[model samples]
Target: MKKLVLFVTMFIMVLPVRADEGMWFLMFIERLNHRDMQKMGLQLTAEEIYSINNHSLKDAIVQFDGGCTAEIVSKDGLVLTNHHCGYDAIAELSTPEANYLKNGFWAASRKDELKPKSLYVRFFVRMDDVSKRILSKVNDKMTEAEREKAINEEIALIEKENNEGGKYTVSVRSFFQGNEYYYFVYQDYTDVRLVGTPPESIGKFGGDTDNWEWPRHTGDFSMFRVYADKDGNPAEYSPENVPLKPKHYLPVSLNGVQENDFAMILGYPGRTNRWMPSGGIEQNVKYAYPAWVESSKLGMDKMKVHMDKNDKVRLDYASQYAGVANYWKNRQGMIDALTKHKTAATKAKAEAEFNKWANKPGNKEKYGNVIATLNNYYSKTNEKARHDNYLVGLLRTSAFAALPYSMGRGLDAYASADDAARQQILPQLQAAIDEYYGNLYEPLEKDVLAAQLKLYATKSTGYKIAPYVAKIGAEYNNDFKAFVDKAFETSIFTTKERLGEFILHPSLEVLKADPLYLLSNDLIAQYRAKSDEQAELDAEFSRAFRLLVQGMREANPDAKYYPDANSTLRLTYGKVRSLPKDKRNDAKVNYYTTMKGEVAKYKPNDEEFDLPKKLLEMYEKKDFGRYADKDGYMPVNFLTDNDITGGNSGSPVLNGKGELIGIAFDGNIEAMAGDVIFDKDLQRTINVDIRYVLWIIDKFSGAKHIVDEMTIVK
Candidate 1:
């Protein structure tokens, strides 16, 4: 079969990498990587890095906003994370008259800190390997469904037993394709407040144009303070709450860095698919990612128009727009880099080798069919994945549909409730509807829905396309614009006033007759119809993947193996290094970018390149301050060979002494495919130098009081 050859080619061409590459678990650092890390300049003991019984580096890091990593910088719980990590909270606190997102925000004092309705930081309490306990319940003889159920049940029981009567949050995660399992315990603090942030010009400088590019100049950092009850225990936000006094915090290092300087990062890296097969990579590059890129660009285009026109809309949509635009560019890079590297072909060759090992007489029953099975399934479902992407993208852009879909559940509850219950719930429903309308803008939603609906009707097929969308298209003679016109003109969901009037006297009959409500239900139904089939296929793929990886590890027992990232705390270490250039690309890159370089990129009034007047004045005067490196130039950003992925944003980049020197924000463009395959020669971790963060705080923002809290060292 053609699939067999592709897999064969992929396996044969796979190359081994030598540069530092891994997101290693903390518990195994001593036995597995401490020696190698020391050879590369690690000065701390493995226990010093992640000891459970004593204060260590692990105590300083927290998972920020359930996604990114952040580090405590002061005894009073001041936390440092990437600017984009806190963008959503900043946007939430902004107003048209005093837009924090546009002008930036500073607390000035602890008393002035602004707390959001919901924001939390989680501390890493401990982690334990539970592979034997979990695998004791699962075996190769069981069917995929049975294996999954057994593992889930074992994980649930282990998690429940370890929670300590609901005092701490617990989770069990699989690593190395379920060959290993670990349980993590966490303590969550809810009363977190915004401390400060730079203006969009400084924080998000270079925007999409320089998002994942090198020679970077973005500040890309923000500050927040965690709070607790007077006794220093985690509690809900209240006026009586006080700043938390954490067990450990990182001291800022101003010693500066040079090429080959030791660098390490501690953070929660979200996810990586380094072990995925050639078939999977081919599908993502050829089918799935292209659709995602197109739809995301469409959504970003629509949002930018409305955001540029209105200040209020800009503040509300700033976070949403950045999030969409980030992935839009990332997906395009993935496609380009994967194709250029011949990634799929390389992976197929590797699969060929795996097949030979898997088909051995002793291993035939356990692993023989995994490659063939995965290839066959990928072939059959490639188009469906593309269709699903369009459908998901359409819903993402249709913001109005969310209100009806979400509120419809509330209304359904009301319809089924007794008279007493209705009296109790009506006011809550009213408040919900009011809040929804507060953020909704009819014209924006109408335009977005029109674009998405047109794309869906023309490009999608089978049960994937919502039936209501099809009906509207047919009625309007395939003119989605005209159909949108009618829907906006007559739909109750379009106007707050109309929706409010209906909400005053809620009933199931009125909702059933409403076009938007009916459409919401139809989309939900269509999405659910595909869920069961997808889950079945996913189970098959997961089981095959587990067997394949397990077998490979056995066949090559001497090889060094690290788990793929899964939003769990991990450590990666390497040295500051410049990327080696090739014939296809020869852009000269330095190990660091300076303030002069940042000013050089400036274009007055340009959204992505503009700098503050004060920044320019300071730069012109050469206000190097004490934070400047010995060369008399202030470092803005630098490069490292550290392996990292998405969730590693805002992670602390530390030196051998475990002192914070920079914050990892982005990765090099050539290494965009690093998530799927670690490239030794090309991959680099992009970091904002700690000196820049302190300069912005002390000189640019004039917030030295906050700076005084950090233990800065020369």
Candidate 2:
């Protein structure tokens, strides 16, 4: 019940997410992939990740901060997405007595459908190339730090002054390391509501058992409806939040998946970093994430002990509990995969080849041990950085933390250091905090910020915090400072306190003189600057990747050197596969699940299994119709490891023929390293095949009318 309420509260608050494509741009480098573009295979001269300004497909791409992606599968506001993507909604609309996790939610009628008070989805209306304008001030001579800032400021200014209006999702992204920028205009709908979900047995069936493994039988799909005001304007939730009348929507596919059938996932993939040195890779294999899993497991166990004793703490911490459980399970899987398997060894071999070539020429001195240096950095930083959060969060308050969050980068707006093109973004950046701040948590969020800084002090600087701590007392917003004690006389305390004090109360003269702070200027400047820097680093990394790719080409010219994901609408083709961890653990992998499994996992022969008795009879019949598998069985969905992360949720998995295959949800635990590398051999995408979803609509809920609208391919 608490999970339901918490999800409801978060449902209303929306979030933002990025990708790329062009001709002169495509032809610019006359290369398959360029740093100017993010998709080039390894060992190529391509610069960095960039959007294709002239591609139709690029413009058609959209992102939602709602933890999922959807495509217009119909003329109405009906959206096609993954089941796990809609988990929170399903939970919110569920009742403890009904426990949607055990059964599932199926709106008997449009009016009866469960409505999530604040559910929403973003539609991509258009994308604008604001690059030339963004980089007008930059040059080859500037320092890396300086260049990064200039590029950022420029992009922010562009987004601020001119926007696509509030009806849609909007964001600006920098690509190719200060080489380019683009603004995405998205149509946002507030009328999104729950449409369907498989019982947890099917949707998330297998629970922790099959996550991140192959030969998996996890049904991972869900459905929702989008509503709009009668006037076709974006509005808050209301009886007025009518069903959305959409321009486009994806259809539910009933076609079956076969071995080696071409498949591609189209959605907002979270992230990928294929440029880290072998050293960093080794850290992940050794202590970094492994230790993290252990620590998280310990904390979660402790939390559970406390939770079992007290219900309020459980309710307050349920979200945290769920989160920690999820992370612990997933991270453990990843750690096991890295250590037990040869994925890291594969990367090490590739780096060694690059080292050989680098040594043959003067380049060897420049790039030879780059991998080692990176690994060294990883080894040195991981332990301290991973554990620093506890210190930071436990000691500081949000207001105190904001000071460092702002200026931690440098002097001057990073983007302002460069060009007029970059300057164009200043106004846009200036308005960002005001635009997005309302969507963020300010106090509980402070805990995370404090934790980050606390860790940084102890880990990097070896500086201890003053025992004299401060917090935002309930009475005065965040003005309460317990730091008014003598213990802060220590050097480290004095240094940190001085910085904090200045930030909280900058010279009134400086504060007033600054045009940025009058508004949410600080946040605006920070994002803009960081965004640009991110682009620059990615672009540089692309170059390094090319060097690595070259070695691969030399080693196996026939093998495909897949490019890093750049949030662009790209396709990855793979088949449903599995991992045989051990004899006893060899698991069942499938496309969908059943309530029976959920009952077995939890209530077996118990009162909970009777949810079906209360449900409509039509749902009791296993008539899965055309959406059923070839085995004459109903399926909910299946998961794959096609190298995806956060943003990939709700992404449509398509076949090689460009047909929808499944909805991408997550990467199996063995695939978390996907953030920095794509393990072609093991990275899988969690997908809910459309056929299983159709079964829920046609057979389970007698909602054939909903499925009728889709252009089901097979």
Question: What TM value does model 1 have?
Answer: 0.95
lDDT of 2: 0.50
> TM-score for each prediction?
0.95, 0.63
**How far off is residue 396 in model 1, in Å?**
2.2
* True-vs-predicted CA distance for residue 679, candidate 2, Å: 3.4
Q: Give candidate 2 misplaced runs (Cα > 4 Å).
A: 1-64, 93-103, 113-117, 127-136, 165-170, 174-183, 303-319, 342-376, 379-383, 389-570, 575-623, 636-641, 656-659, 669-672, 702-705, 708-714
Q: Candidates' lDDT values, in order? A: 0.85, 0.50
Return the top candidate by lDDT: 1
lDDT of 1 by residue, 156-262 (tens): 99899989989889999988888899999999999999999999999999999999998788999999999999998899989899999998999999998888988
